[model samples]
Target chain A: MVSAGAGQAVDEGADSDPVIRVRGLENRFGSDIVHHRLDLDVRRGEILGVVGGSGTGKSVLMRSILGLLRPTGGRIEVFGQHLRDADDVREIMSHRAGVLFQDGALFSSLTVLENVELPLKTHRQDISTQLRRDLARSKIQLSGLPDSSSAKMPSDLSGGMRKRVALARALILEPELLFLDEPTAGLDPIGAAEFDGLLHALHRALGFTVFLITHDLDTLYAICDRVAVIAERKILAAATLRDIEDLDHEWIREYFHGPRARAVRDQTSPPG
Target chain B: MSDPAQMTEGRKDDNEADLVWERGTEGLLLATGDWVLDNVELLSDRVDALAGLASGLDASGISRLDASGALLLERLFHRTGQGPTAAGLRQQWRTLFEAVDFACDDTHEPAPASEAPWRQILERMGRSTVEVVHSTHELLGFLGITVHRLLRTVVQPRRLRLTSTVYHMERTGLDAVPLLILLSSLVGAVVAFLGATVLRNFGAELFVIDLVTFAFVREFGALLTAILLAGRTASAFCAQIGMMKLREEIDAIRTLGLDEIEVLVLPRLIALLITLPLLAFVATISGLFGGLIVSVVSLDINLVMFLDRVEQTVTLKHYLVGMIKAPMFAAVIALIGCLEGLRVSGTAQSLGEHTTLAVVRSLTMVIVLNALAAVYFMELGW
Candidate 1:
């Protein structure tokens, strides 16, 4: 079943156009289906958090939107360009969006600075080597990584620093949209909060849309403008935190009303 | 959206948030605009240059600040010891500045750029030597553990994975037959041709039969087959086990209370032991058949005469000696492959490196063992 009214409700609230629109999306691997008639929208310049239980296809949805995976059936549009006919999705998406993979996915052979410089070198082939290095260095610094980390290999850095390097690489091209897959999955609470704060600050300063796939409740509360809960092979709800919390879905109630969720909410709330 | 570079260029202009310097009695410097992450880079060079000249820092003119911008200001203040000037900031800005100051207190200093080339080479040499010793020690330890596990499985026959052993036999042995036969046949013909040419010059052309029979039965048959298997099956084992390790499947097996050596290594080891000798026998037969064809066609030796010569020169002892080396070669290859696979670390690069290492190591060990067997059989007057 498809929910057109719910999708339209999202469209009406945003002043700007939706950066990503998925309608009747279906993903299947042989006989096993991951998504069915999934309808969702991510508005421009907003941090939209996608949350779901394990194997619920949150990642599949993200991959479909990024054009990494071809959906079995759907009309998926990014920046109003239909992805179905694109011969090279990677090349097209590389100009408009950057993704931070869960494991950082930094090239093991390259230093952190070189990893950050890769996108710039790939896209801006005509730029001088010196200017490329300068831009990459600024991005690394903006990610809150120290100057010393520039020459170190990804394997040599801590998990948190590696994630920062990945973030730096993702931001190097200055894309209009950024995709992050479990950005804070491995970091400790303090480190995750700091990463969340960095993402929030970067979003405000750069005004780019973020499609963040995460299981971290604190991230949704701290940085997300809206939250989309995926269950039963489709989007169960897509709205702000308060609205998602009030939804009647069983999984949604369990997720938002769980003890851990309440604890994070209490901890993040301002004192009276 | 049309051109990403143009979008970045437009954003760059907006992010060049200006820095204002006021000539005052106190030589105070004022910064304005959103001195945040995006705009902070524009001020770094100016801040560093002015840090030495300015008397003190003033953030009163700053409209906004974040961690990135505050870190720069913190560095400027640290360089000039102008901490007292931070009091002029709003509460939020002051808090952020203080936080950055505390967070970056132990900031890592970049390593010095210059090092002597000779010293660097020496350091690398020393490191490599240590790594070689460490890896050798690990390899020996792995061998000992594998042997012990194998013995344990021998004592408890139920632990041996019979189905896995059969599967590996089909992969490493059965699948290798055609290539082994083809290679041995070609080599056998070449050897016969060379021997016939050389022996004919000395009026000993008939002795070509001895050369073909002795070489194939004693060394060429087992050596070629083993070398082929080392390159083919050993590398496959390394890659398979290495990928399993990378994916943590080996760890999963361990967590399930299974002995890794018994489950992973023993099947491959037993399969190779059983199949290598059989493959070597087939190669010996195929090689002799090739020599038979050459003798019949080139030398005009009849089938009866060829069989009589082979029967007389190629004894059971020579065949036994060659077949004996087959199991040893198989053991070396399988052990090396499994060892290298288990030694694989995190990356795909590491898995590739280990796979190559397995083939090289197995081939070297097989050749060395074959040489040692040759010397032993010669000394014993076989």
Candidate 2:
């Protein structure tokens, strides 16, 4: 896997063409500001990792980015297009920016192949049934599973395998931007690390932009080129992990300098 | 040490100051800068999001839970809290909370248990218990909102046109036939046998054909078939969709822009519609065949004589009325199953609860609809 910041490019166009720019974004469920005035810039082809404390609203920020949550008071510009209207959301989704939900969100009645085919067939109007099935077949293979998995329902797969299948579904339209929400939340450290490696491999291979909302520092350091911490209804820093370390907020520092952070630091740190 | 009027005046002044202070920052932000009211000032915004999610949502229309609180908290702490003064308390409290470190309402910091008064602790516990019940009732209100939404979807002038008769025929009609045939045949045989034993005393066993056909068409076949489908298929639909909803798969579909009822419920409704008429057909034939067997063995009436008597006694009209009642029974079953499935939320227990309710409601609706169809058809005459 590539080291953090190793994936940096000299391309200024992507930086200027920020795929999503959130300003003063806030979310609430009745009376709670889940995130308060969160501002962030997710550039095209940039793997921006969102990290935070348990209740800091990492997923909420992702929701706001997807226009799932109407940011209480702010702006979200997606692909230089503000997601202020229904049309913007439809436009962005049609561009094949996929979101892999934390629970895998595989429809139970549908077989694994059908789940992967769903997004493709549901969105497209002209693709024939045979073509859809063919695309679904390729997606099953792209997900790194045996052809036998095509007919099998999601209940038959293990958690880790289920995640890979979800990852495959996200890639079915060959998304330009992909959102992986807690891709490795409940996996064992080894499983998480393996998932981390798989994501890095895919990111490097495809060069597709990935916005990951996760708590795993190993994932943030091992794979993500930049980190965005969503808290206080704002993103603390939409910069590299090192830049976030320099941010020095209690929640951020306590996270990176905390026991979990220290462990990743020692492992990634150069020997004296 | 304080004058009472002076203390009261100071407190009122502080309340006004607090209100003023809040208005300057947090209150202003909360009032307008909030998510839904900001630039998204239209009711169409949520509908717009649902449209976005319609392409994204699974068949159940539930949305994914936002699961990133800790990361949000980390950012909150990092962005805004360092001063140590009366002025900083607001920022500190705001920063700590914006970080999601603690709930604004949770005042129970770990004061020593021995220092705490027992009466206060009991009173707090009692208050919390009441709050739990209050929330539970509010949860039902949320469910009512969901039900209202479902009714709105169903009551539209065009109604959705979800059920395809051909698709329904395959799933419901063919699969349900054998069981209905078996059940009706046994009931028919029992009725004929009971008739034969009594009719032997008078040597007038010819009326058994009339008894079996009339009873099967009027009462037994319609209700029995309804109960069977209600138990077997309707409950299964509720459980299946409910589980997908609980898994957030339905939300995933909605976010993806597919209509849930169109994808999940329509085909099943069609299947029931197709199946019910076919099942009624089988029930009538099997019941007649069973009575024919009883006639040959017990009443010394041959199959030919029994058929002739049935033709004379029970015409095409009775069977026609029975067959026509099928689609209404199917609609009632489908409506109940879909409604109960849509009611599902939260957990596995909720799925089980909805499934049981689907069965009960389907059975009730089936019986009521069958009775109504029978009455209306009879009112019109052959």
Candidate 3:
């Protein structure tokens, strides 16, 4: 089961074509292997939450798929196009997918409006400056940021507002797929809940396929339709929260039935 | 989800985005093709040309629509002062249009007006004058604090950061020895050669030895070492401390009830203070060796005689004059580096600006202080 192929997880779940598929993924740093034969399939229009303990290579896996880090060995197909054979891998990937990094990597020197407009300036140079600004502003508003936050620099905004700006920049192109890394980390409970609500609403309205990596159990429960647990350098199981909770694995049991998870679960479920 | 499939289908070949206006009977605007970000420019221009004629719009023919495309539609509606009817649109495109409409509803307020250019120039000059004065005040205050802590540490030797001081000494002092020796020796040889050429014309070639000794002992040795340290060690100190400040490590130290000055600045100051004078001593010796080699080879001066002349002319008075300036230069360089580092604000751009400022200030201050000391020593007849 520890070495189960990612194809197996797809066979056992909802019957939808994969948007992002990884097979025989291997990542190694010097002699230390981070992932070995890891496989995953992100289905269309599903919020697939990827979770693991610290140093379990969750970020590494995401980076490999995004082409930020080239894996030592793997076959990756995004939008049914093989990454290695594509003439312009980044061009093919970037136009279709949007990424929200963990720390809201906004440019420190630019105002929020300029940060959001950057992608349009890069990919769609034919768009008039006026239309580009309006589209960026609309996306910012759609991400639930206030009107005042548009003119301020990233350094001037609070952490939560900065994440919203990053999200706006990511969603500017109206990409069909979204990759979110720890979207709710470094936020207070209320702020995290608000962010989760915003993300869920955006996902439903946009209907983009979401590959979300998070450690916040609340985020998983609130938005994710299925959860993929990375362990032993492969996905041990990929299923709904209830099915994952019922699995008799030690880490899964401790993770799902832990005190924190219990508190979140009780709060989420309807009263008996 | 249904729209994305239709989107891929529309993008396959000749189904590119298009907008047409019928100025005939109904004056209908029929939008067709994939209306997404990729085709926004062509779409926006077409929509603008027909904005006034859009009495009735039919969007059912459009193959695909995204938020950006929705924004363009909303803009057209706003320009014509008419609300979007959404009468014949697909369900998904209708949802997208409504969402874009609601989100982009608010109009932007115009930016505040600016002052005239002439008035702005005058205001900027006056502001910079005040800023210069304020910075001078801060520099003096920081110097006072550093001196106060040094005196306190002198009284209680146990308070010194011995480990940190030694570590910095190895980095800023020991590692820089070879580069210092090479530069000093090269400059000394050049001076000796120049002196021999000029002095030989006057039939006083022997005086070249005096020129080499005076130049290296009183000016070149100390000044060169200080300038080199100003460029090298000061920039290093500024960058390292500026990064730590950027990461809030300085604030962390303070929150833990530790004096950041004692933990960070004092060690660098003490290391530079102790090592600069020693480096100057080495520079002076190597410079003299360079002069000796030139005299024996080019000037045909007797080796024993050269040694005797150097021995007699190298008085402690001249040596003291140069050696005394090293620690003063060291203090200025270290303080400016640390001060600029601590002044770094939150952004990476600010850190870079501060690092450059640290090097420029330290280098300028070193040269200015050396010039002042030269005038003072001459007045005192040292």
Q: What share of the true interface contacts does each candidate keep?
A: 0.00, 0.00, 0.51
TM-score of each: 0.77, 0.44, 0.88
What's the true lDDT of residue A216 in model 2? 85
State residue A120's C-alpha deviation in candidate 2, in Å.
2.2
DockQ by candidate, in order: 0.22, 0.03, 0.62
**Where in model 3 is the C-alpha error above 4 Å?**
A1-11, A14-16, A85-88, A147-151, B1-14, B85-87, B107-131, B194-207, B239-258, B345-352
Q: Tell me how many residue pairs clash in candidate 1.
A: 0
Chain B TM-score, structure 3: 0.83
lDDT of 1: 0.82
Q: Tell me the spans in candidate 2 whose CA falls farther than 4 Å from its real position.
A: A1-14, A128-131, A270-272, B1-382
- Cα lDDT tens digits for candidate 1, A147-214: 77888888888889999999989887767799999999989999999999989877876667999999
Please give the range of 10 consecutive residues that has the lowest summed lDDT in model 2 chain B.
B29-38
Candidate 2 chain A lowest-lDDT run of ten: A1-10
By TM-score: ranked, best first: 3, 1, 2
Name the lDDT value of residue A196 in candidate 2: 87
Q: What lDDT score goes with residue A16 in model 3?
A: 44
Please report how far candidate 1 places residue A76 from its true position, in Å: 4.9
